[model samples]
Target chain A: GESVGLHLPTLSVQEGDNSIINCAYSNSASDYFIWYKQESGKGPQFIIDIRSNMDKRQGQRVTVLLNKTVKHLSLQIAATQPGDSAVYFCAEGRDSNYQLIWGAGTKLIIKP
Target chain B: EADIYQTPRYLVIGTGKKITLECSQTMGHDKMYWYQQDPGMELHLIHYSYGVNSTEKGDLSSESTVSRIRTEHFPLTLESARPSHTSQYLCASSDFMGSRETQYFGPGTRLLVL
Candidate 1:
């Protein structure tokens, strides 16, 4: 499925429950990927990243799963907290340009 | 915990005005990038530089230009601001040359052109 080709506005999710954000990249040669969390009034903070060689990678509280066959990427957060409410972005490495291609962010919300 | 910094966190300028957003890093990174983002949206790469005196335009067609005079400094300039140019500009740096390198970002400069 073509996932990351379009640019959208926002995303909303609840707190406490697990949160899953999805991204679909356009390029197939993109070998590396990263997830970033941006809080209000702050710059993006690195979450986790995965290379083409791996299908899944886990961090302190986040996990990144990559499906190269479909060019799909996902970020999963356990026990989402209010402080976790922010915009999450997915980025990829451009094989030809040596730059990262970014996806439209998914805004995670923590509904009290 | 990134040492990158962007000045004039917020700016409101009139159309046709010339503006420059400054970005600097103390991490001594070799790769730097400039991205234009609307509030909470995808980041469009505007420009990038691999090292001093090296720069290249990005995927998005941008009216802004950037310069890399020093390894740690990559500033973007809009010759003439317009309403369409109103957006948040973010600066990032990376250690380039590593197979797995992370890009650290600055707080960003929010520009509102009226």
Candidate 2:
């Protein structure tokens, strides 16, 4: 019964604006969370990741926030550009295994 | 960039034919995985291997079989390809550093069974 899901299927944002994608998970025992970006016809690329003990983590142009109380995770992208447009997925890892449970991806669209 | 690679970036095959999806990584990662994804859908783990000769089925039940005979190569085979097996197969690898090790992925193989 462990599953991860996104709050929205698509998000449209103006170029240079910020984008926020949300994810929720049902397994409280999951200790690791990761964010991935998948371009069309390509595999999921690792963007950033955070542990259960951390509430927030930042990358070059992205940030991942984890809220354990509500079982929510969010990825924030700054200065959204056309090249930044892609499907973003959030995954949670079980403590006993290395496999990741993926969430429904959120498609980020950038408008000129 | 990740050094992972998948062969036959796109494949169109007839039903009942056998097919193998090749995946290789030059990063020397100890963990490798195979995931299935439909168009505009999330990924589902089909198989994984912690090291050579250690293969395990993932959460999703898949008819595809995988072998880890070498450290850099993990291939998945479909004994009989079916229309229902049409999907994109992604290969990923990660080191056994810790729980939060980042997974690097290859460009994936898109298979269409006619």
Stretches > 4 Å off in candidate 1: A1-12, A94-97
| Complex DockQ per candidate | 0.69, 0.73
Residue A63 miss distance in model 1 (angstroms): 1.0
What is each predicted model's overall lDDT from 0 to 1? 0.85, 0.92
lDDT of 1 by residue, B1-114 (tens): 999999989999999999999999999998999998997788888999999999999878879899999998899999999999988899999874456767899999999999
> lDDT (0-100) at residue B15 of candidate 2?
94
| Fraction of native contacts (fnat) of each candidate | 0.74, 0.74
Local accuracy of candidate 2 as per-residue lDDT tens digits, B1-114: 889999989999999999999999999898999999987688998999999999999877879999999999999999999999999999999864555667889999999999
lDDT of 2 by residue, A1-112 (tens): 8899999999999999999999999999988999999999888888888899999999998999999999999999999989998999999985677778899999999999
Q: Which candidate is the best by TM-score?
A: 2
